[model samples]
Target: MPNRRIFNSFFLGGFECSSHRRPDGRRLDLLSATGHDRMTDADYRQLSAHGMAAVRDGLRWHLIESAPGHYDWSSFLPMLRSAEALGTQVVWDLCHYGWPDHLDIWSKDFPDHFGRFAAAVARLVRDETGPQAFYCPVNEISYWAWAGAEVGRINPCAVGRAGELKRQLVRSAIAAIEAIRAEDPTARFITAEPLINVVSGSPEPQHIFDAEQYRLSQFEAVDLLTGRIEPGLGGRSDYLDVVGINFYPDNQWYLGGSTIPLGHHAYRPLSEMLEEVQARYGRPILIAETGAEGSARPAWLHYIGAEVRDARARGISVEGICLYPVLDYPGWENERLCQVGLLGEAEGWEKRSVCVRTASELRRQQALFEDVAAPEPATAAE
Candidate 1:
């Protein structure tokens, strides 16, 4: 059997560390709101106890680089140290939907400043931790483009300029990847984006084309990063590394109507989606983020897990799955308890309680996969 690379664990805990500007121009820091920022030690302990050996987390760009070219590692150092002590591997998000206020995202300087900051981060992490690192350069280029540029729902607040913003983000991400690689030769990158299916509401050719185009648009960011499309943004084939697919219950929907009922005639099986991604890029893939709120969380994981197993059975290098927002946090638009995490917040900032139902299901699913050993790759097609 060929040597296979896997993350430290098949299960990962993803902190909801979104630091983004809301529609009202207010900067929201979810790490602070959930108290995870101040409770790194306790959080790491809980993660290890729950058999989560890897995590997806992020740095608050605005806080660290309060001024141009200045980064305050004081805020992030503790978390890094804690994760290292706990033997947890981390995939950090360099730009989690927010950046320094002094920088103009539209200006050419955005990528320049971001690249410099990324290089500096790589150096500090390499020196302090002395291990290979993984990074998602920008959290979700696709969703950010639509929400921030097209709808005027977030920062940069540009209406009808999503394509332009996406190019800018791709430029920044490419620059960051190059800078980080220059600092640490072995750095790996994961591009996190929503994977979806779109269907036309009618049988008209135009409607069909619209849906097909909408579906294709989801891959634009990754395509740009890979030089498969939009090579002008300094994208190249080397820049595209691992791919992280973020899926939710509502991801599959009619182009102009309600959510597509799963298992319906039009609903695409996630196995097919994973296959399309593999056939397109042939890179390692991870279900970077998947979760649900309330009682549906465990069932959602079970369903996705089974699909992932099926994908792997087809010889896809589908990697481990991640439960994003492993700890419940407030909703972005409202302070309402999202209840989407495997763990629930406790009264004390440093403590959390596992959602018993989700935890049980996770163990059951883990056992289910373990029972079926991974089949050896076929050396010759029969």
Candidate 2:
């Protein structure tokens, strides 16, 4: 077995459990849609077979809290129990771009109320599964802001209010952290944000500055959490625990232009990006979400694993890399089958089906990791 720190395994599987509504106002339950919710035990067992001892999943806020001050754990408890039974450590995501229908996001007490709910969740988990649980409150604040506020892509479907949405998400997350600590002090939090690089396409100096600034905007969420940039949101150093970053092939681009894929001339190396993140926050990092769709899976994984290996060689404390949405599911926009996950949809609730090539590649990487992670032999005795 590999000797691993921070998590039981160096690799983690993430499920796409987005409960957000589309711009057309139709609610999406990706977990249920993919049958993971109904097949928790099998899902976890399948992940464990792939050597993923840790997983990143979500608890649908809207489904959990149907009414104010009340919670229905019908959809969550079973999944938690399944993970425990399968010996899979989980980093739970609370509020993944969706919330209770009765509550207004812009309301004055949103943060406080969210904090209270988060506290209750912490207590529930502690009472059920014991301590040292991981949580990501209000997942991807910066991305959510851009999606929901800037482009009206998702719920709360507002436009021209990116700053406002960001501030609110940070406030809610901060408040939730405090509330959760009140319930369980040993609980760890993950501030998951995108790590991207942008370059200027224009020769104008102002354009260059704008592009760079936009790149820096990716750190605003963690900056607020650590009180580095936006202290007004009540962020403190302690609030920034394990820094989680999401990266994909399309992460880099030229400002006002096309995406610069990995290995392109203008594309930035992921190792350099990881180094910058370490320099900025001075905390351990987890590649919370990363994967490519269809035939790009194997190559993307190889690239990411190499980058992470290089990052660690440079003494960066990169804890793990997660194959996000490790199970193939319907797309949020058009419900198309995204063949990204290592596992495909199962025919039944107890048996799990997998993508063969994906599974092979995953195991190949696992064996390689084990070789590196194994301890050295004993020295010659006198």
Inter-residue clash pairs, candidate 1: none
Candidate 2: where are CA atoms >4 Å away?
Answer: 1-4, 371-382
lDDT of 2 at 246: 96
In angstroms, the error of model 1 at 158 is 1.3
Candidate 2: TM-score?
0.95
Candidate 1 local lDDT, 244-317, one digit each (tens): 99999999988889999777999899999999999999887888999988999999999998998888888888
Residue pairs that clash (backbone atoms under 3 angstroms), model 2: none
Q: Write candidate 2's Cα lDDT for 120-174 as tens digits.
A: 8999899989876889998999999999999999988999999999989999999
